[model samples]
Target: MLPISALSGAPIVGRATVASIRLRLPLPEQLPPAVRDHIEAHAGSQNRQYLYVPSPVIADQDASAPLCAFVSIDYASDAETELVEVSRGKMLKSFLKQNFSRDADGDQILAALFHMVEHLPCYLLRYSDVVAAAQALETAFANGDAPSLMMPVLPAVENVELGWGDSEPDQPLVRRAQATVVDLEGEAFGVSADQRNIVHLDKGALRVLGLFDVRTREREVVDILSAAFPTVDAAQIENDVSGAVRRFRRAGLLVAT
Candidate 1:
């Protein structure tokens, strides 16, 4: 059965099918002052506890600002209680690389990573790969490679190729256009190298890498796509081209102007 709690993070696809139980509970306004005091006396003494404040009084004069909700996590002594606490909040650290570092907001980082994985053909790292990378990181830490569990893997995306190599020179006789992902960030959120590491789209990405010779301006991308598929419509070409740009740009290959 699906877990039930006060709040949810990410998106839940469906509702729980368990039998609903009604309780004879007092309404917030109807509760007596002594009962309220009794409830407050025992608050925050147990594991997996959550307090939802319906309305809060603000002492500051800036009352024009919208009311903001707060989430609190209390330490739990039991395993089940700890798991429940973790599940209540969104697991932002797992999905967002920026969460691993300072300077980025947790929500923004999660949103960016979500957009990349959803739209792009990014793959999640397998158990084996994650383990191997973990070991490598541990060894590095021991040998002074920076004491941290930082496993950076640049995985491939489907139908997208990433690599480094020579480009076909511009010539009138050959008309060969070599395409490489130079600068990828065109939109607010894009498929970046970090996202690539999380999602493994390697083989297909490698194949595309083999085809592309060099990375250039966004406009130049059209030239490469045209050269690769001469008969492809402009619209069709545009879609893949934009994705490529975003991926490469996120990888630091494409520099911002």
Candidate 2:
């Protein structure tokens, strides 16, 4: 799958793993980096819940409320029963909505998780991808923008190789086939197939890349471009196509047959 790190507000695509964090708070606000870092590093990996207390209460070290928050992560393919959120108070559902939004109904965040996470009978605001998404929430604060709903995700980089490549026969190379393209301040950015790298394509390369796909042969791609710009020489079109395909494949942006 394609990494969504490139789509994040902070968008630092590198050799990073994806993890989840849930924030249980009365209201939404900017999470200091210290808090975020503390949660990311100390949070248990066994899917156990952790009591997170911000600056004022970090020293106390308990799930006591009115100030602190609870932190937890959900993994893909986890084996928990119900999709329900288990908390001391059922009213905490609203916190789940605003912090990790999904759709306009403010429930879109969990909509995707509904298919993946195990049942948790507790009060918590879960994140499908906190590394990327935590920055998203902080983005609104940094830019002074209004809060919005999103299930903002990052590639769940598992320590285990979830699976291997697909079994298809001689599939044609496709451009951005298992990828997503986004505009970062007018620049075109995308993720690699392995979901570990971020790549940027220039206007020329991107335009050429768009012309190739699993269903289209390389010759047809060249022909399409040639007909589109009749003034350009056919040889030039072929070279452009070849160059883009080579660069894209090397960067994992284009699939190889």
Candidate 3:
């Protein structure tokens, strides 16, 4: 016997997939008056919070002049910050010893110290034992024994070295040199290896030295000078060149080939 199926007339529907579409909305040209006003107020508040305002520590100064600067602190840990503070304390102490009065008040001292560390002359203290050198330099200026204001010719040297020596009460104090080159405001300086003293070369000295070549005779230095200073008398230029060569040789910065 065969079984009979009942109510088999139901409709069968096929499955269909739906695709998704994204729509980008355009910004409005204008906002409501109140909404626009609220937005402007918010922007003004942000500006007030983040705007750069110069320190008002000075009085009657030009607004354009920067008396004090700000630097942001960035450190990975508390130890790093502490290390920086320690270094700053040492630098401040060193700077005060060389430049400021011993009896200055705490506020004045701090202000001056801050200025020194923030300025270009600060590098002298940072890089070298400059307390003695600074005193000697000042004395030289006072005694009129300073190097000639006029520029000098420079001779090429094989090496520069720095050394330190004990200072005697009766003798002039000289800065102890280190075994490194000092770069100050873009000027390169080296201590003489033979003399164990610091040597400084100015722009004019560097310019004159740049002309030196193996084929250039020592006497030809004056010729180079003539080209450098066409307006100056040849005799005076020659004398200056000769003086420079002697000075450099004595300092052991230059050697005869």
Candidate 4:
């Protein structure tokens, strides 16, 4: 469990073993000497050790402005795991003031900051790659060349039915299940499940899954998402949705329409 201070949005100020660090981009070589020194002084002695850096909450002056970064970090210890937040805006501003010329363009600075943070280690899937692929898919959709898509869940195989008397009638039942793809020879692979082996779903992918209806068209789904998360970029959402669909399809959880 995280300290109540951290849970309530206070800066972490102690030693912790991190499981992962998700930065908007990797640490830049040109970081302000003070900030870099602070990080190095604070970093664990072990090489490649995970460090948690929380996603900073930005108060956008313009409500219509798009977010530049959404980074997160996960810390794991023998007892539990916690996420530590960092402010991307403050971090970038510190670096820019220290490293760049005052005449630098705002867009250029933002781009540079994004590029710098983009190098953080990702254990499973790189969100930047997902965003890139999503951009390409968005282009295809705009060109009226989007592919037909479908969402499929695990299918019933060799069902073992249960009777109503299996448990108390008024008791609420919680179902925990796992699904795996089996080859022609009945060998299983690509297993995902709840409880001990839950598959990880990023925010965008979770949203897509929530909106998914079997055999739903990509365009229609995108439209629905546009209405739901009005502040988010449609193209980015589309990319995340398409990426999840592709992953599921590859895992045999989805099929082409």
Q: Which ranges of candidate 1 are over 4 A from the true structure?
A: 1-42, 45-94, 97-210, 215-234, 255-257
Across 1-257, the per-residue lDDT of candidate 1 in tens digits comes to 12211111332111343322221223245355764665555443232433422112223322221111112233222212211222111222233432353444443343344433333222222222323434543443354321211222323433434333322223111101222222222212223433432222233343333334343444455566677778888777666655554454334333333
Task: Report the Cα lDDT for residue 151, model 1.
Answer: 23
| Candidate no. 4 TM-score | 0.26
RMSD of each: 17.6, 17.7, 32.1, 22.5
Better of 2 and 4 by TM-score: 2
Ranking by lDDT: 2, 4, 3, 1
Q: Which candidate number would show the highest TM-score if scored against the true structure? A: 2
Q: Which residue runs of candidate 2 sit more than 4 Å off their true CA positions?
A: 1-171, 193-195
Q: Give lDDT: candidate 3, residue 91.
A: 43
What local distance difference test score does each model get?
Answer: 0.34, 0.44, 0.36, 0.37
Over the stretch 1-257, how does candidate 3's per-residue lDDT look in tens digits?
01111111221111222211111122123335653454444432223224222222332321222212112222221221211122333344444454434454343333333333334122121112223333544443454421112111222334433112221212221222222334434544433532233345555554444444232444566677798789999888776655554444444444443
Q: How high is the lDDT of residue 9 in model 1?
A: 34
Q: Which is better, 2 or 3, measured by TM-score?
A: 2
Tens-digit lDDT string for candidate 2 (45-87):
3323444433322223222211112223343333332223343
Task: List TM-score per model, in order.
Answer: 0.25, 0.34, 0.30, 0.26
Which pairs of residues have clashing backbones in candidate 2? 86-120, 86-121, 86-122, 86-123, 87-122, 87-123, 101-109, 102-108, 102-109, 103-108
Best-fitting candidate, measured by lDDT? 2
lDDT of 2: 0.44
